[model samples]
Target: MAAKAHLQEQIRQLPHRPGVYKYFDDEGIIYVGKAVDLRKRVSSYFTKQDHNKKTQQLVKNIKRIEFTIVDNESDAFLLENNLIKQHQPKYNILLKDGKTYPYLCLTNERFPRLIPTRKKINDGSRYYGPYANLTAMNVVLELIRALYPLRTCTYNLTPENVAAGKFKVCLEYHLGNCKGPCEALQEEETYNQYIQQIRSILNGNLTIPKAYFRERMMAAAQEQQYELAHTLKKKLDRLDDFQAKSTVVNASLSNIDVFSIASNEKSSFINYLKVMNGSVILTQSLEVQKKLDEMDEEILPPLIMQMREEFESDSKEILTNVALPSLPLPGVTVSTPQIGDKRKLLELSIKNVLYLRKEKESMNDRSKDLNEVRIMETIKKDLRLTELPKHIECFDNSNFQGDNPVAAMVCFRNAKPSKKDYRHYHIKTVIGPNDFDSMYEVVTRRYRRLVDEGASLPQLVIVDGGKGQLSMAVKALKDLNLWGQIPVIGIAKRLEEIYVPNDPLPLYIDKKSESLRLFQRMRDEVHRFGITFHRNRRDAATLKTELTEVKGLGPATADKLLSKFKSVKKIRELSEAELVAEIGKAKARVLLSYFEQQEQAAE
Candidate 1:
């Protein structure tokens, strides 16, 4: 029989409920999928019109179809994600290029110390970051060593085991980054406090450390320890270098993800950035389209979701490899909040995107277009920004009926992703697809940190949509007492129109202008960021929701099964005995009965 005929024949056996489906090519390579309505979703492949080139090609390669019915779409989605990760089917675009992201580790010893490593070291000490870039991570490490002057010796320096002649402080002490703790030149109590300060700063809680430093400086001055006070002053000056990079202000937010999307004639790029505490931790870039092939839905939102899944998986790997610091205060849970420092971080991500776009435009033309330079100059003047928004920031929101509402901020420094700075925000405030509320949450979370610190701000802020989002962001700035001082604009989707704050009709800068390209890129990146966050949240929610409907399953058991097996097909492959061995016999039996009933219903 023809491939379509075989698929249609198989579809006739499928249940009209949530389930996972698999397609096998002649070589028996399997591609896995999940659908809310397996019967309807699979049947569309055989009967639906307007199949894209990728789908048609997929259809042609299929030699057989297989499916397992589930109780709901949530199960199907979870099963599908797991299956895709396990089988790595060619059809599902897999994210996370396969290696775990790196994180800084500090061993849990009586004498805790910091070091750079990828694997999780849960010995006892604090872990600082799954930092987005190695430079940023290393810079913090260097700063900690310089400012704290703690030991970095590899020899066993434990109190019970320290040998008189076994070890001494390395050359680091001579260079002034260490306090020579190896030789007991530095007291254990004092060094311990310095280590605490380093960990605190890396976790994005600096207020306590700042205060501690001030108190110590004052105490030294009162004691007439002129040299010690001056040294403390120098250390305080060094702390400013940390501030020179990014100023993250405190907000009541936790664990928020931000995203932004941008596109040109050839391809669209979505940037996903996540902030934990006040730190910008990770950034991801997703290709929205490849060649002429594209997804059926409009590109912005779906692609963003795809990136979020990739980034989230990466995040898990990071967390496992790096131990989290203990919360500074009780009742302060970890949350990806929607306001304060989080919002500013999101805006910085957008500027990174715009900067890249502008760089591309400038290089595309052999000659420096004077008009382009003028536009750039005008942007600098209008924004009162120090640099030619040679770096720009933008924001956008994506959601489906409030379920997976998300916001993204992409950076365009010199018109490229700054891939280092792009961020995604999982919307925390608005539900039910309220774009304005979502954007407001994102802006406030991202920027409140910077505003609180009184740090220099991004050159410009752009929104992916039109006046409404721009006004929403503007209102946030104004409320924070940051209105006219910073430039905010919007990019309308249909005509590639630009809307600056207070400007009514859309403004179209020259297509060839670098400044225009920069703004477009920023807008696109934020859209991509927002969409990716929404999709991942939606798919995750769907999976969680549906899995709950299954008998004899709780969230813990479901999460374990999904994490262990990663797919329904794999779960199906396991015998009841194997399942019972992993979970309990009772739960295993319940699962078996559930699958059996679902299969029977499909039949």
Candidate 2:
């Protein structure tokens, strides 16, 4: 109680200005938070009643509070993010998959080398992209190499070394891939011109190179250098292709950063797009786990600052989907446009974040499917089956008092239902709800058709009964010469026991095992499907009988009424005019009188 009052008193004394705050427990810093007003934000924790369990626990454990007043909200945001990155506070949200993405580095040297790196150094070098993946980075590097004859050797390329003629040109120079800068065969000024064009291309500005190549191609053609002109044309074509693929936005909107966020109950997804000279130079999507229920206004600003620092974005203008509070940063404009190209760019960023969210969901679903496949393979090995049950079909018989007996077969492919492949059968050549005989007929009919039609077969077949049903299915398979070719088993409903042919002892799978759960799912699905089909058939039969009993209603009339109205009750409820339109007036009157008499009789 004393601690609570003291914390509240400290909160009341807090300055009403932008700052970062740290919550301390006995062990260490439990959480770090930032706010525009130190007093209002810090006081809310002790005053508010509706915090999430994690936040509530954090507040409970707070033994001391510390804060540092910043100049404004932007500084506080940057400071808070830096502190969180450094300390990784227990209660603060953190990026789960935070690792530096790869960048294409152009080294700062007389003969600079183009290489892919994961680290960014500050030694006067130019880096492009923290590219989304290595393949993209490699594509850019390949394009650069094909267009320009840059030196691949790591020679000093110092004026003194070249003057003394101390180095020799390598095989790259002989192959016409390098300009032989090591042997002073290429002028530094000419090489740097190529470097400048390459840099422009990497920055999503291809006009410089395209124009230069166009001029060179025309000059070579005028000089009657046909081969050289063709080479230049090919380079131009490559540049055009690269540019066409790279640019996705309006060329007039240049030097802007796009940030958009999408959040759910558990995590937030933020996507960043760096547009330079109207081309997207960099793109990244990051997911941060939500440790507390923080609003987007609170979550996005800090993330924007952090991403700006991480990507080293210096764009003065940032576009978002919503208006942001003014930041303390000098000369930065954050705007949410309602129309025009900027709005379109904002929409694009939102689209990217949504796509990334969907992609992550799809990836998680695929991972789950892979795990299920592994489980099924384990089941196959454990059961000593001939093949993995990539496709499985389960059969169950349904009947109520030997009326409208039917069977259903549910198909499972890759551990999920294939509804299109499911089959339903009306009992033929079997009667009185004999489970074994019904199983025999269904299995024989299913496989015989597959064999005759040359259709693919399931690796495993399941019968939803015990040993008797198993034996019957085995006989049917043997009749079709498929007994030993396909594995068949039966599951008993009472004990959930599995029975195999010619095996007296039943296989009792562990109740908690995924294999058993899979079998249970198959059994339940077949049962449900069989029951639904049986019910539909039974209802149709009942309707037909009831219609036949209606006086003055012929079989043809009954069929037409059932085809139109679908049921006797529905036909009875139709207006006299509607009924007359379907049948004749005389039949319509008769139908109305019959229903009236029935209602009166019920009363």
Candidate 3:
């Protein structure tokens, strides 16, 4: 109690500004976080009753609360990343994969050999790609071999060694695989030109080599050397094929870094693509496991910083799926591209992450835990819920031009739909296209009635809209005192940003995750259900006046046909045979003649 009082006092003294905060126990700093408002954020630890288990435990151990005020949220995030990494906090996400990837090292020598190596030493060697795809790297190596006849030997090609006749040309030279720089059979300048061209290609500038080949082919043709021109044209074709294979966007993309992230219950998978001239020169994927339930927004900055450091990337422009306020890099432009070449690159990076996520999931499926229980566990972890969401319900609102406003709730148990528990709600209190108020009213009515009837509430609640609808739902939950008893999430339709109640940043579950698929399935089910109900209600309101007036057709038959077909417009589009199947031949002919008379009158 004394420690709690002390921390509350400290939190009260905190400035209401954006910054990073640290929690310290008797030993040292154990956890770190950032917020746009330090006082409100830190105070939530004591005030909120719905802290997750990890957070509750963290709050219990915090003997001291320390914070640094920054100018904005971006700086706070950057500082939090640096502090956690420097202190190695116990309750921070840990980057786990430490395996060294292979890089194509071009040795800084008289004869630079393009070779694949995992170990990097600061010996003036230019390394390209810690390639995520080894086959792609091998293809590049083969292309380089076909383009240049560089030596593969490790013999010292020093000028003194060659001048002293210390080395001799071997079978490689005879096989046209080497220009034999060891014996001074190839000049250093010519060998360096070959290395330079290879270096350009490695850096994803096929323009250099392509232009070289094109110019040579043109010169050969101009000199009337048709056979030589044909040979050069073949090389040009090979270069074009290689370029087409490597490039992910238009040929103008250069010096832009791309990063995308996907996460499941425990780990975040990040894919990084270093683009040069529309080609991905370096592709790498990393996994970071969560210990403190950090969000994608919190995970990405450090991941980007760590990756940029590991690869020594100096690209001025970075494209990502998540939006960052600012980066530690100076003079860098970071954007989340919605459309254009950069968007395609970002999408390709996301595809890479999705593939990695699927591969990891496949490996996990080999274990025995990938059943119904595992799905609930995954939902619990991925959504950061305190308990398993075994019985989940999702809500969606539907309206046609602010008419016949209706909402639906679809229930799922054990990761499958429960049609018996499905509900459709008509808008009663609110009118117009106000989804926010409609959601609040529906949630209040549903849960309050359940409470009054002493019925059990669902383990999880999901709303289909962005922050506005989510906030309304949360308000309803709080008003009913069900906030701490149940967990609710909202899924935005377009971007799929999962909004939680207190957290400002949204969570992005992996696109391929079963948990996310469950949410989507529930969402889609509600949309379908809600729209169907809304249309029926609207038609019913119309039929009370319009269906009774159809001449020679009794109200019973018109109501039956309209209710079955749902609308008169749809009934008109039906074939006579189909209409006969519903209302019989004589009625079908009368309805068709009525429609024909209406069309003739209009004409």
Which candidate order results from sorting by lDDT in descending order? 2, 3, 1
Least accurate stretch of 10 residues (summed lDDT) in model 1? 316-325
Question: In model 3, how many backbone clashes occur?
Answer: 0
Q: Provide the overall lDDT of each model, using Cα atoms, as 2-decimal numbers.
A: 0.67, 0.87, 0.85
Q: Which candidate should be chosen as best, given lDDT against the real structure?
A: 2
lDDT tens digits by residue: candidate 2, 1-603? 123877877777799998999999889998998889999888888778777887788888998899999997778877887898888888887743334777888889997888788988899999887777788788899999999998877778789999899899989988999988888888888998999998987887899999999999999999999999999999999998988888578888888999898887777888888998888877878887778777766678878877777667789999887667876568989998889988888888999899988888788789989987887886797577877899999999999999999999999998889999999999998979798999999999999999999999888899999999999999999999998888999999999998888899998678888888899999999999999999989988898887778788787888888877788889878999998999899988887888899899999
Residue-by-residue lDDT tens digits, candidate 1, 8-45? 67788888887989989877645677677888887777
The TM-score, computed over Cα atoms with residue i paired to residue i, of candidate 1 is 0.51
* Overall local distance difference test of candidate 3: 0.85
Model 3 spans with C-alpha error above 4 angstroms: 1-3, 9-19, 25-28, 35-37, 66-75, 96-99, 133-136, 217-234, 355-366, 369-603
- The residue-level lDDT of candidate 3 at 148 comes to 84
- Candidate 3 lDDT over residue span 311-377, tens digit each: 7789999998987767768899999999987888899999999999999888887653458778889
> TM-score for all predictions?
0.51, 0.62, 0.56
* Weakest lDDT window of 10 consecutive positions for candidate 2: 93-102
